[model samples]
Target: PVVSDFKILKNAGVQEKESFHPLRWFSLEQNYPNPFNPTTTIRFKLPNRERVWLAVYNSLGEQIRTLTLNTLNGGTHTIVWDGTNDIGKRVQSGLFFFRLQTKEGALQRKMVLLR
Candidate 1:
């Protein structure tokens, strides 16, 4: 005769790993003064440490300038786009887009440049 030992594992209903911080939806606020003159402020927030990239693009989906490109901490941050290209050349007044991308996700906002 052989004796068998069986053990049931409990607490299986309990979670083990820590849950993520409430996903603070990242946002791209509208550039102040719809038709910004010389400069404008762009704002965004990060819920955790992530590689952030903030750039400006023309209506044609062309990258105009890169405002931020580095590892950032979890917090709110802002950058100013002076309505210029990568070479410091002022762009023509038209519709533009401010894009933000991170490990979390990506967000895009529309802006206007007024000469």
Candidate 2:
């Protein structure tokens, strides 16, 4: 026979039990205006408070710039990317990617830049 570990609470002759469920976190979007000339926005959401880092990279996997890095509360947030590098220098027109890393998982989406 198998035994399960569970506890019951009684308050004034009433009994109560508790249960648990798993949570799943995810990001919901790809940026618009890809192949943009100047700027574009990236949006995502979190299910709980977590440390997050958002960055942009070139096709070669080299990080171009960091858009955000901090602990954020559960909700939606957006970041704008101006076609530039970490040094504030304008980048060339080509394929790029926006990446998000959090306690749950990592995600990446492709974008483009145009002169």
Best by TM-score: 2
User: Which 10 consecutive positions of candidate 1 have the poorest summed lDDT?
Assistant: 1-10
Name model 1 segments beyond 4 Å from true: 1-23
Query: Model 1, range 83-102, lDDT digits (tens) per residue?
Result: 88999999999999989988
Top lDDT hit: 2
Task: Report lDDT (Cα) of residue 36, candidate 2.
Answer: 89
Can you write out model 2's per-residue Cα lDDT over 55-104, one digit (the tens) per residue? 99999999999999999888889889998999999999999989999978
Give residue 13's error in model 1 in angstroms.
30
lDDT of 1: 0.86
Give candidate 2's error at residue 25 in angstroms. 1.1
Model 2 regions lying over 4 Å from their true place: 1-23
Q: Can you give the lDDT of residue 41 in candidate 2?
A: 87
